[model samples]
Each structure stands twice: as C-alpha cells, then as structure tokens.
Target: MRVMKLNEVINITGLSRSSIYAYMAKGVFPKPIQLGPRAVAWVEEEIQGWLQVRLDERS
Candidate 1:
C-alpha cells in the first residue's frame, strides 16, 4: 500500500486541488488519511480504484 500527497494526486487525476476537495465534500472521492496535525495523504489503491471506476464508466 502506498500513500500519496496532494500534488501527486493532482498529477494522477489531472484535477486541480480545489476540484479534489470539492469532490470530497460531495462525498464522491476518497478521503485522505490524516497523518499529522498538518499532513494528510490518500491511499494510492483507493485513488487507482476511483480512476478505474471512471474508466469503466466511460466504456
């Protein structure tokens, strides 16, 4: 399992930071794991799964 930071998430998903947070707010995206008071990261597998779902939907 791998943890990914916001910038990496942006690169992988091609989404801007605001869009990611907005999706999270709408309960449509994976929430990040809080690593520290000022640090957070998402599960890489979860993000990959999310991407797979999107790709599947496109088919």
Candidate 2:
C-alpha cells in the first residue's frame, strides 16, 4: 500500500489543510493511518484514486 504524509498529500491534492481535514470529516476522503505517536499518513493509492475520481467527476 502506498502511503504519504499530510504535507505531501496537500501538495499533490492542492487542497488546503482545512479542506483536507474537512473532507475527511465528511467521509469523502481517505482516513489516515497512524505511523507513530503523532504521525499519520493516508494510503497513497487511495488518495490517488480519489483524485482521479474528482477529475473524472469534474469532466
């Protein structure tokens, strides 16, 4: 499974931190996996697919 941190996700998704968190809260985004006491990351493939879906929807 591919995984990435918040910063990388933000850069790739072009979504603001607040918007990313908001999407998660609304159950529209991938839930992050905790990698440490305070570190978390999303599954890379899932996020990528999510982005693809967003693009497809837009088109």
Best candidate, lDDT-wise? 1
Give each prediction's root-mean-square deviation over alpha carbons.
0.3, 0.8
Q: Which one is best on TM-score? A: 1
Give all candidates' CA lDDT scores: 0.99, 0.95
For model 1, residues 1-59, the per-residue Cα lDDT tens digits are 89999999999999999999999999999999999999999999999999999999999
- How would you encode candidate 2's per-residue C-alpha lDDT over 1-59 as one tens digit per residue? 78899999999999999999999999999999999999999999999999999999998
Clashes of 2: 1
TM accuracy, model 2? 0.92
- Candidate 2 has an lDDT of 0.95
**Candidate 1 off by > 4 Å:** none
Pull out the clashing pairs in model 1.
none
